[model samples]
Target: MAFPLKFTLVTALLLLAACRSDPIQFHTLTPAQVGDHSRTTVGVIQIESISVPPQVDRAQIVIRQGNSGLAILETEWWGATLVDELNSALADQLSNYPAQSGYSVRVDVQRFDSVPGQYALMDVKWRLRSAGESEPARVICRSTLQTPSGPSIDELVLAQQNNIKRLAALISQAAARKQAGCLMPVN
Candidate 1:
């Protein structure tokens, strides 16, 4: 009968609609276009280790909803873990330092806050030491890098990217000079 056929068709359509879900979106911290490589250095920069906060170290990007709330985005994910993303991004950017002093950097992220339509903030404690040196100049510094972002997810990622770029620059400069001790907080 036409009634039975119509009911079956409606059920099939409902099933199809229920099965459709939004595709997962993956993002990365890698720069779209790398900078010039003409800086000629003695050795390459090695990102020794990167440690992010437990709250934001997963594949999904965590956003600070308010003063004390955190929202984990299920559908949006990073290409890799948060630590891996930082290691890759820092290695990529620091490779261009014009300094001859090769060094290794270790970063411990105390707080990685991402807020939609507000800002992306990175509060990290980073250390740099010369490579292959018996007594290397060890420098430890903490920096709070913040960048304004738009409401979109892409904009938030871009903001975080900018923070990474700035951190790379600071590490590059520090390694170049071979600081003897801890420095003040950078901007």
Candidate 2:
């Protein structure tokens, strides 16, 4: 009886372990090295924004398809919904590159009012300046996913989130490079 009980316990433990899934994997990125803590106030900066039309219903990527090279059952992942993920990512990325002198940066739907001499004109526009230039005068930036096949909603969200993050980095870098003294990067 003791032996049977021990075997059952071991089997149950093993089954439980097998049923558990591994954590989703992702790559790590280190923030760039920029020196100093300073403060600069940006007055009424116009955020020229553009959004890549959402491709919500259409599958941007396909996974686990059958041998037809890329054909299989289609599934939608949750994360690829739309703006929420992008906005979060963009905010995170831009947080590091703050406008002069450690001033608090604000972004919103309403156009900011410039106080002539007090506010400096910062045009945040979006344009294909180069292969991957961040929008020049846009506050919020957007891009559409180029899905390979039908991806699960989770996968879509992850992929889109990652893309937004990457774009944020690129845009920040571009802004830092272009605007002489506009934004000061985090040390």
Candidate 3:
């Protein structure tokens, strides 16, 4: 009787342990902290539309394994779809920029890659159109931003946030101009 009772308790304890799992962690691309600066802008500078690659648009955080492989982390997720999170982050940062005039910006991401212990990269083709300007007056430009990362997913996320913030800065600076020139490279 004693042995049977001990066996039942051990089995129950094992089952309980098996039921536990690693908690899922959600992350966002938004600024980690709000700044002291005002959130209002002088003129309208809206991010008209931004498109991300379909491959990376999922809720799970997908990372590069090597040159040709990718890994989707089930326990790591974005707060929302990747595209929505990215747009929100950019909009939040761009809303504080002072524009010479109203401008609408559009970005189409060509590549977005995150590698643990490596780097985060964003290559995008962006266009800025002056408010009330025709399509022919718009100037399209491209920028590729890369940030170094440490060995952890958190570091990769931070690197990607930096990349997005840099992209927003580039957009804000280029939107201030109405010429038909491309954006200058940023170091």
Candidate 4:
């Protein structure tokens, strides 16, 4: 009886070890190194907020299908929370500008959808306010950056990185225009 109990305990331990999975690999998105060489000096642009939907705010990558179904990839995760990663990427992207001027930016991410082997889509509403301005300028930007995923999560992450780069470019352009007094007041 003692031998049987010991064997059962050893079997359970072996099964538990076998069922253990390798640690999940985490990934991060980085800002593009390219800068606007035309501008010698850029203003201080502060990121006020970066908000995402609850489904995508967590560390796990959320893949959505149509309107209802969604899958959270447990094996693949962001290096940090999605919002933090985005904030870091955006701040890094804007760091190329000179810090002479002052501007505040706020972003509301409506959709951050990724489809393996297909495309990555990002739709965002953003606001920019120059220092001392009473109201901010608002814009809606959307990008359906496409890349052959090769059925890999790395490719999906790459697509997301590209989309973020595009968004940063748009925001930079807007900031340049505002700095140059090219943009008229919406009101």
Candidate 5:
């Protein structure tokens, strides 16, 4: 009986320690707001590469009537916290372009149906990966620059800003491609 009890207690302690370990999470880079040729320009669209979750394990203990004890039980979890963090960072960075660039470039946060006369909802897909051996991560990011046939000047400005942001990020990634180590944009 004593042996079994001790085994259970030890198992519980180990499990607790594992649970208390700090969780790993990724961080995002700041967006660059600058002016260029009278048009608002984004110096860089810095995005971190998506990260994988750490492994987790749980321990369990079992006791036998014969006064023997056994500890056996481990589990793992696949969390998407990293993904959520990236998504939030991207959305936040994209949404702030208009104000940061003096509204010279527009940053639209609304959704609608069609493009121009046939207005439709816009779809966005963003992907990021390491470029060979570069210092910056390369990203394949896209967004539908949509508006009514005659979008207001503000709307058009926002669209251009959005495109510029995407372009800056992509160009940075491309230049950074061919090396691995650096994961964020420089300058």
Candidate 6:
């Protein structure tokens, strides 16, 4: 009877251990803390739309392997939808620019991928239109931002955030040029 009880207890413990899983972590692309606080405020900018690739539209972090494969990290997740996070970050980055009227920005992300120990890349086509404008100015931006990473996902996220910030800066510059009547034709 004693032996049977001990065996049952051991089996229960093993089962419990096998069923346990590591807690999942959620992350977001937030704006960088460092900024020019003294910069003048820009008029409100609305993110009209943000579209991402279907492969990366899910909550999990998708990683591009080589030419032919991808990996979705099951334990890692975005704090919100990827589009929402990118839009929020872009808005935050552009808040400092001064503008008299609201502007609308649209972003279509073609590629967003992170490779561990390598780089994070974002290829995007974006449009900016001032209030009541008949046409929007468009540009395609490609960023390959690099960062050092160990076996952790945090570094990859940081790199991606940086790339988004860079894109926002480009948009802000383009908006300023447009306001100054020096807008360039999209290529």
The TM-scores, one per candidate, come to 0.89, 0.33, 0.90, 0.75, 0.22, 0.82
Candidate 5 accuracy as TM-score: 0.22
Steric overlap count per candidate: 0, 30, 0, 3, 15, 1
Q: For candidate 5, give the lDDT of residue 133.
A: 40
Sort by lDDT, best first: 3, 1, 6, 4, 2, 5
Show model 2 residue runs off by greater than 4 Å.
1-50, 54-81, 99-152, 178-187
Q: For residues 37-141, what per-residue lDDT tens digits would candidate 6 score against the true structure? A: 665555856678899999999888999888879999889999988988888887777775555566678788888878887877787777677755675554434
Which ranking of candidates, highest TM-score first?
3, 1, 6, 4, 2, 5
After superposition on all C-alphas, the RMSD of every candidate to the true structure, in Å, is: 2.4, 14.3, 1.9, 5.6, 21.4, 4.1
Tens-digit lDDT string for candidate 5 (1-187): 9999999999999999888854432222223456442433353233443332221111111111122432221221112342443344444454444221111111222221212222222334444443224433234444443333333323322333343345344334443455422233222
State residue 104's C-alpha deviation in candidate 6, in Å.
1.1
User: What Cα-based lDDT does every candidate model obtain?
Assistant: 0.83, 0.35, 0.83, 0.72, 0.34, 0.74
lDDT of 1 by residue, 60-155 (tens): 989999789999999999999988888888787786664475678889999999899999999989888877557454788888999999998899
Candidate 6 ranges with C-alpha deviation above 4 Å: 32-42, 133-151, 178-187
- Which candidate achieves the best TM-score against the true structure? 3
Expressed as tens digits, the lDDT of each residue in 1-187 for candidate 2 is 9999999999999999999875533221222337653423242111233332322222232232232333212332223432333344455555555532221222221111112122211122233232223424333333232222123334433344444444445455544454433332221
- Model 2 lDDT at residue 133: 38
lDDT of 6 at 20: 95
Candidate 6, lDDT over the whole model: 0.74
Residues 43-133 of candidate 4: C-alpha lDDT, one tens digit per residue: 7477889999887989898886666889999989999999999998777767655444577778888888888767777777777666555
Candidate 3 lDDT, 68-112, residue by residue in tens: 998989999999989898889888778767677788888899998
